[model samples]
Target: MFSYRVEGTWRRLKRHGWSRQQPTRRAIERDEDVVDVWKKETWSRVRAPRWSVGPGSSSRTRPGSR
Candidate 1:
């Protein structure tokens, strides 16, 4: 019976020029302008929230009061 080891298989794959990659696929109905707006404005707000209410302020906290 033939058996394969993980390490050996990984080394063989690498030697064959195989690489791990994730290809991003955008939705067919995706809108570039809306995405740009969200990235510029909504992304910041979504990434950081006010009133952390914890030990020390969060570094992700947005500047200025909402």
Candidate 2:
């Protein structure tokens, strides 16, 4: 019979190429209300592409294809 502690299990997982992701921390002065307003009012317009080349036209999808 064998058992693993939390630390031992974590070590084994790390050795097997497993990784742990930590949640990012926000600044103390961060304001969610302002962020929400900006996202709704500004982000949409800012994120839009100025010009589009059209659909299914990425160069990486089919190189040298006419």
Candidate 3:
């Protein structure tokens, strides 16, 4: 897991109301590729089951369920 401070050139640009620049077709395709990679990586590392258990698995019922 990684924690970032949410501060940087991109963050600052976003905070100051810099909209996403119009990307060229190639740039858009590249961005989509990056997003797909990130999505796959994220889901691959997720530990939760596809379906949630019932109330016995709830916070009040279980301590440190993971």
Candidate 4:
């Protein structure tokens, strides 16, 4: 059977756009807290657009239609 393990810091870094590379177990385990904080900051910068309707709107048009 295959086994997998995750570190708190590594998981956080991943959410912040960090790439995965093979590292010694000790390094990742030691840095979990710092990584988590960075990930949260990075994620918050990502935003989604809001939509508004105007008088010219047509019923046949879809959300993404131009």
Candidate 5:
């Protein structure tokens, strides 16, 4: 067996037309259209401004103050 450095072996393989094979990428059990609609509407509701509570509200911390 001839001793060859990894870089030299890789370069030789590439020169001989060898290339890396990547696995096919895909999301399993995913619905792209439903995800898009949820992103557009439901996501907006998540970031929607919340109401601020104050003295004008019905909840009373001190009954004397009310």
Candidate 6:
């Protein structure tokens, strides 16, 4: 494999249509208190990892599957 400089690598990625995602901006009036509460309560319930394989599924699924 060939080594690349930081700028060169980023340029190559961009050339291949892999633009970096822009940072998400929050509203100036966003409430930190509400955000914190949601993180503690709502996020905890749904933040569990989803990558676990079930009994019949492997890392590779059926090759011809859509």
Per-candidate TM-scores read: 0.37, 0.39, 0.27, 0.26, 0.36, 0.37
Candidate 1: C-alpha RMSD to true structure equals 9.9
For candidate 4, what is the lDDT?
Answer: 0.68
Q: List, residue by residue over 17-54, the lDDT tens digit for candidate 1.
A: 99777767988899999999999998988875687664
Q: Tell me how many residue pairs clash in candidate 4.
A: 1
TM-score of 4: 0.26
RMSD of each: 9.9, 9.4, 10.4, 14.2, 13.8, 10.3
Question: Candidate 5 at residue 42, lDDT?
Answer: 96
Give the Å error, residue 26, model 1.
4.0
Best by lDDT: 2
RMSD of 2: 9.4
lDDT (CA) per prediction? 0.80, 0.86, 0.70, 0.68, 0.83, 0.84
Q: Candidate 6's error at 19, in angstroms?
A: 14
Q: Distance (Å) between predicted and true CA of 18, model 3?
A: 21
Candidate 3's residue-wise lDDT over 1-66, tens digit each?
865574675687788899668856575446876788988998678857676655443477676573
What are the per-residue Cα lDDT tens digits for candidate 2 across 1-66? Answer: 889999999999999999898768988999999999999999988996788554553478786554
User: What is the model-wide C-alpha lDDT for candidate 5?
Assistant: 0.83
lDDT of 4 by residue, 1-66 (tens): 844467766787888999778855575456877878877886567655557665543557665445
Off by over 4 Å in 5: 26-66
Report the Cα lDDT for residue 28, model 2. Answer: 92
Which pairs in model 2 have colliding backbones?
Answer: none
